[model samples]
Target: MFGGSDIKIDVKKPVYELIVEHILTNYNFLHKQVSHHVDVEYSAVLTGLALGDGRIHSAFKRARISDENAGEIAKKLMDTNIVRLLKSRKQFTSWVDDERVSDKLLFTTPFMRFWFAFVAPIFKGIKEGNYDEFNQRYENKIAEFREAVFKELSNELVKISFAEEKVVETGAYWDREVELDIFAKTASKKVIVGTCRYTNSKLKKSEIAKLEELANRAKIKADVFVIVAKRGFSSELKSLKSEDIRLFTLKSFKSLL
Candidate 1:
């Protein structure tokens, strides 16, 4: 899609191979330099794990590569703009005071995460042109795959919802104590927090409770709350009769565009 033809998907090439080609095209460091390395296969394994797990330790373990090799692969990925680290949103809290926090690793885009999470791991089948097997595997796990994309959309909605205010911050919040799926603040200092449920069942009031709990543990009060749901809200949640809350379905999110 980059130039409409050269980088776009077609029926001829399998999706797994397409993503590999895309990465190989963009990351010249990975393409030109890493490919020349004696441990190229090892590097590719680490790259796939990094994209799939979003954890450095898990990536190393999955690849069964030494820490030294994993570190080199990570440096290449970072240098080539394929992946980046996300620092934990929890700061200046009880947990912050007690222990050191680690950053979460994230892909630069939704497609990269999707490709790595499901496609890249089973590359042999893809190379063998086993489209049926890849399709079945992808179909079975796509709902889980889209959660990351949905979370990204939910973050976008927070900014859209607060258009009147100067949004100072917006991102996921996590500490040893709790994790707020959507967190933000306005220039007026309004605290907004939320969560997303990308399942068939309706979102419930307990979700709000969870956000409140996370806020309490992190010692912050929210001036507004939002919910992004795929199915919709429960009757109890819809009838909550509260003014501080806003709800968004997948359909409603389109309007924000």
Candidate 2:
């Protein structure tokens, strides 16, 4: 069992090491009784899960483990009680209820989140000596990348919209049909909706219009409707402000941090 910070650290350790360290720290803080039992391959998966944002499929993909190896990896993790294998394809497919895994904490972490989002998608490219395409794809999705960055700095974002009463639940929200890149709800039921735009382009009225429509449909009367853009807002959009709308650029968001 990995306990008491006995894990070795190296100067040239991959990014995954940092991810594992973060997970260990977080888990220790959350539950003092928990300990990690990990090997190289399992470590890779844990690293993937920590970086991959709770996406198990992406974590497996990033570890470069084949379908054949997946079962073995799943078995190891499950046996160790680090993660529970929900579905058994060998017999039949079925769902595992959250209640079963709640105590087990069978979920990936932020490191795995990034791994699945970036590394796993390009496994073939890495194997076939063609990573350019994969790299380009990552570059194209800079908006999502920025949003992840925002998620990391979400605490500060909440601080800016401080109120007399402290809010508890603050996180992003997304559903099957509708997805809000950033969603924050206070204990008092005040909600904030934010959208992220990556390129140098400014946000258009059309985008704002869509968000407004979505918010109304979702039945969220957001107290603050924020728009986070990389380049900034357009003059036209900025000029036509409503009571519910606020604008933020990448610089402004970082400043909040």
Q: Which predicted model would earn the best TM-score? A: 1
Q: How does model 1 score by TM-score?
A: 0.75
Candidate 2 C-alpha error for residue 116, in Å: 5.6
Question: Across residues 107-209, which tens digit of lDDT does each residue of candidate 2 receive?
Answer: 3333333443454445556445555765575567535544555554653565465565355555554333345656665566666676766666777877788
The lDDT of each candidate is 0.66, 0.54
Position 215, candidate 1: lDDT? 81
- What's each prediction's clash count? 1, 17
- The reply for model 2, stretches above 4 Å from the true place, is 1-146, 151-155, 163-167
Worst lDDT run of 10 residues, candidate 2, spans 87-96
TM-score for every candidate vs. truth? 0.75, 0.52
Best by lDDT: 1
